[model samples]
Target: MASAPGNNLPVFYNDLIPLSSVDHAGYRSRTLDSAPFLATHHAVPLTVDEFVSAQRFLPIIFSAGDEPVPLALMGLNEGVNTFVDDQGKLRGPSYVPAYVRRYPWMLAKLRPDSDELSLCFDPTSEALGAFEDGQALFEDGKPSDLIQGVLKFCEDFEQAAGRTGQFMKDLKDLDLLMDGEVAIQVPGNEQPFVYRGFRMVNEEKLRDMRGDQLRKISQNGMLPLIYAHLFSLQLMRELFEAQVTQGKGPVSVTPAPEPAQA
Candidate 1:
């Protein structure tokens, strides 16, 4: 028999794969209670590939769906870093493809019955809970510490490219989600990656950042904030796409950020 939502099984004790139940206390899934949620409603999915590409949601892949998709992982993250060609060499960022940005909603629209499927408001409730927890840790730890930690991430990458650095010096001013003040575009084209009212980064500072920023950093290029913000919006696209693929119910998730650690 199986256990409740947040209890029992998969324990650990030094070095032992026991035949019996282990009952680890720390391992628990995130909450997906039936609460009223406020998310974007998608009567019709968008038409952009960056919108539904698997590479964008690598950071939160486990949380995107209850069950896993049978595709290989790409872009930047732990677990299966690079893609191989006939020669068995790691491919570059070209793995995602230039066309995805133009057809973002293809994955969700692949199934004709997308409207019948429900959205996953809290697929990786546990991971979302952890991010909320991490936020609170930053909030309570120290402003200086929090700012330094984030800035260090940006500054380190910038310096690793054989250059000196200036510091960000503030987090309150560092939106990192703002569109900044530039427009990035693919070569031979004037328009940048846009959805509804959102746009990808087109500035300089963020283009150098790594991780999610690196993934979203198009060949057209933009700054850091664009990467962070656009990555988030892309995740929503994937979440909706998952619904269409699985044929679930209306989307919803628990609202409040997870409680801070004591």
Candidate 2:
């Protein structure tokens, strides 16, 4: 299950194995006891479908890259997740990203040239194996109900991804995204700590949009998503306070570097 450095695998997924009746006939999937694996990630990928619920807890932002993805920030600092304790236990009630809930199993293209995707699971995950206490992956050499459900979930996620991609493209085409930064002043600190490394919708630009364009965005159901993101920004201070409470606060007061432009 070891992965080489520079592998683009998502967090906690060391290796992906395409599920096959012949190769994984005896495999079984079990319920996970905890999500300590998510402790190392400060942000998790999100779909636009999650904006409403997710906005209530975590601050949502877009990562800066060629293929920017929406993300839910669990913490302000790199590799520091205030929501998860050192023991990997979640601290309080919060919205869990679908990306995290779908972990240990994902849809992947098995070949570079193939457009079709296959259901794959992490070979290193302890929640899967030929165990007595879980659901079987196959029955009579065919996929079991459990596998079918997983496949359905993956399919739905892919569809959501397509929608999210189009949404991002629309934002880009409208030139709504701008470099974003936030500052937090901790107790006993004269200087405020600044965090960056992300992009956000420019509210001023959004407001300046023509009435017809606004109507178009509203009709597409994107107006609420934009508002949700803007509302979530208020949580950045709360997240920073959580980090301070957890003793994982940033040590330096320097402003974060500008994120690489896509």
**Which pairs clash in the backbone of model 2?**
none
Model 1: residue 26 alpha-carbon error in angstroms: 22
Give the alpha-carbon lDDT of every model: 0.25, 0.81
Q: Write the per-residue lDDT of candidate 1 for residues 1-262, one digit (tens) a residue.
A: 1011122211110111111112221222223222111011111111122223433542111111221111212312111122323232323342332211111111111134443311111222232223322333123333335334434432332232111001111211332322222222334647642222222233354444567645543442333323333454444433333343434321232121111110
Q: List TM-score per model, in order.
A: 0.21, 0.91
Q: Which candidate number would show the highest lDDT if scored against the true structure?
A: 2
* Candidate 2 lDDT by residue in tens digits, 10-113: 66687787889998889898887578788877878789999999999999998876566788888877678888787667788989988887878888877766
TM-score of 2: 0.91
Worst ten in a row by lDDT for model 1: 100-109
Q: Provide backbone clash counts, one per model.
A: 15, 0
